[model samples]
Target: MGKANDVQFERARPRIWDRLYPYLSILPALIIIALFTVYPFVYAVRISFFQNLLTKPRSHPFIGLQNYEEVISSYYFRSALTVTALYAIAVVLGVLIFGLGVAMLLNSNIRLANGLKIIILLPWAIPTVVAGLMWKWILNSDFGILSGILYSFGLISSYIPFLANPTLAKISLVMAHIWKEGPLAAIFFLAGLQLIPKELYEAAKIDGGGGWRLFRNITLPLLRPIILIVIVYETMTAILVFDLIYVMTGGGPADSTALLSWFAYAEIFKSLNLGHGVALAIIIALITLVLILIYLRLLKTEEINV
Candidate 1:
């Protein structure tokens, strides 16, 4: 009877462990996320409601919604909002078009495609600050490589100041952004393209569909999901662009590239108004959340249609 009881205990022990295994496996990650992500988010939310300044660090009085009100009424807020909207639109379009073109080139069986793949990630692999500084020098008015090339080829009489003029500074920022971000977008598009069945293209061709017809009917419809994701991601990235503006133009040329995120940084670091900075950050978070919700709705609708 003792031996029989021992055998029964061993079988029950295996069953009990199996039931708790999934939760046990995930416990460490949950603890880490709670410590890092959850804590900071809660702290920021608390800061947004109070008057917290580094200069007056000892006194953090709870001002209710005063910080939010001040941030909204600030002089630069409207200008920053307008600039951010325009920048996000331009960057999203540029990234999508550039990425799609590269994805097509990569998908084709060309002689240079292999060489192209090896170098495609160089722009994205580098740090954003390093990339911005490199572009700053490359577009310098006095001794830029691009200006030198253009002058050498007789395209221009002299080197143009790429980041000195308001319009040119905006254009230069977009160009630099596209160069740095286009590679990752290309990788995403390439993944989507590969998932498409070859039989679909062959069937379209057999049905008398030409190149444009095949792409419009098959590729575009199938790529809709990826396009939605890319647009949303790129829009968020553009709206929050800071490091490039910080390193390259420094929001110069009359604040042409003073995006909302950069505006928040200036408020905190340059002006030393931590309350305003935190308030702006909270507003940014809300804007981003709204945009994400809209895109997710569209994605769901597209799925239902399909």
Candidate 2:
């Protein structure tokens, strides 16, 4: 009877341990995330309601909604919001178009497709600042490679000040952003493209489908989830764009490139208004969260349809 009882206890212990194993396995990751992401977000939220100026670091007072009010009522807030919206739209469009084009090209059996697969990721692998600077050099009005090429080809009379003009600066920023960020989208799109069964394409072709028809009816429908993902990801990235504007344009040329993130940096560092900066940051965070939630609903709808 005693030996039988010992074996029964041991069996029960194993079952109990197995029941808890999943949660135990995930515990360490939960701890780390709580320590890093959760703590920082909570702290930022706390800081946003205070009067924490860098010039008076020791005098952080709870000002409640004052910080929020001031930041919202600022002159540049509206301008920054408008610029961020336009910039995000341009960037998301440019990245989607460029990435989809590249992914389609790489998916093809063209002669240059293999070489492009290797080279397409180079810009993405490099740092954002480095990519921005490289583009800056290429677009420099004085002695820029692009300027010189255009001049040599008689496409222009002389060097073009790309970064000094408001419209051109915005365009250059978008181009640089596409160069740096489009590769990841291309890779995502390529993955989706590869996952599409070849039989579908073959069947569509047998039904007298042309290239455009096959793509429109079969490829596009299959790639809808991926396109949705790319749209959401690129929209967030474009809204938070900062490094390229910093390295290439500095939000100059009449503040044509002043994104929300750039505006936050200016508030914190330039204006020495930590409270205002954090308030603006909170607003940006909330806006992004809303966008993400909307996208998630769209994703769910897509899944349901599928």
Candidate 3:
């Protein structure tokens, strides 16, 4: 009886192991995420309490809230915040407006719709670094195809450095973002447009609703959910945008285009202050967190409506 019981217990142990094996396999992924993603975030938050930077790492010491204070006190930070706000607002609005327009246009009876979609998606599919480099060349003051065209059309006195001037720098960044992100937003809007029941449009027509009126009343209302999602998504992208600015201006022309992300990047890699870099990163993450909370609220409202 004792021998039989021991064999039964051994068999049960293997069954338990087999049942738990899949979850055990996922432990490595969890560890990687924790180490790379979660741990860095946690460390950044801790680092934000001190005054640290790249130049003098050896003399660094803990000064609670000093870095945050410095960030809030710095004129450079304020200017970057203002610039970033304007950039984000412009891109979000443009992407939504122009994207919806394109989506509506393509939703109609058009030949080669699939081909058009593939073409439009090309920009979004392009890697961000490559897009930035491509645009840098396009906006180059000398020997660029765009510059030559503009010169031929008598649009300017001479080569205009789009990435050099602060206003134009911001505009160039916005244009780059629009080119890359607008089509993606349009695709989302197009999906939403397709989901809308045609019967509603037919009913509106029966009631003598015209195109403008029908769109204002029906289409906009239906598209509200998707619009909210796109706004949140685009805003986050704009907030953390680094590639274009890095490639085009390098936050140059006297740091006029230095965004928060660029600032953090410089601190981390350029300046080699790991702790302070981590701190700046934490602040950025907090900003992102706030934005995410706002998105969650909007999502809840959407669910209530549904």
Lowest lDDT block of 10, candidate 2 = 1-10
User: What are the per-residue Cα lDDT tens digits for candidate 3 across 48-69?
Assistant: 7665665776666788877766
Name the lDDT value of residue 77 in candidate 3: 76
**Rank order (by lDDT, best first):** 1, 2, 3
* Residues 220-239 of candidate 1: C-alpha lDDT, one tens digit per residue: 88989899989999989998
Residue pairs with clashing backbones, model 1: none
How much is the lDDT of residue 8 in candidate 1?
75
Q: Which ten residues in a row have the lowest lDDT in candidate 1?
A: 1-10
Q: Which candidate's TM-score is highest?
A: 1
Error of 2 at 66 (Å): 1.6
Across 173-248, the per-residue lDDT of candidate 2 in tens digits comes to 9999999999999999999999999999998899999999998998889988889899999988898888888999
Q: 2 or 3, which is superior by lDDT?
A: 2
lDDT values, one for every candidate: 0.91, 0.91, 0.84
Clash pairs (backbone) in predicted model 3: none
Ranking by TM-score: 1, 2, 3
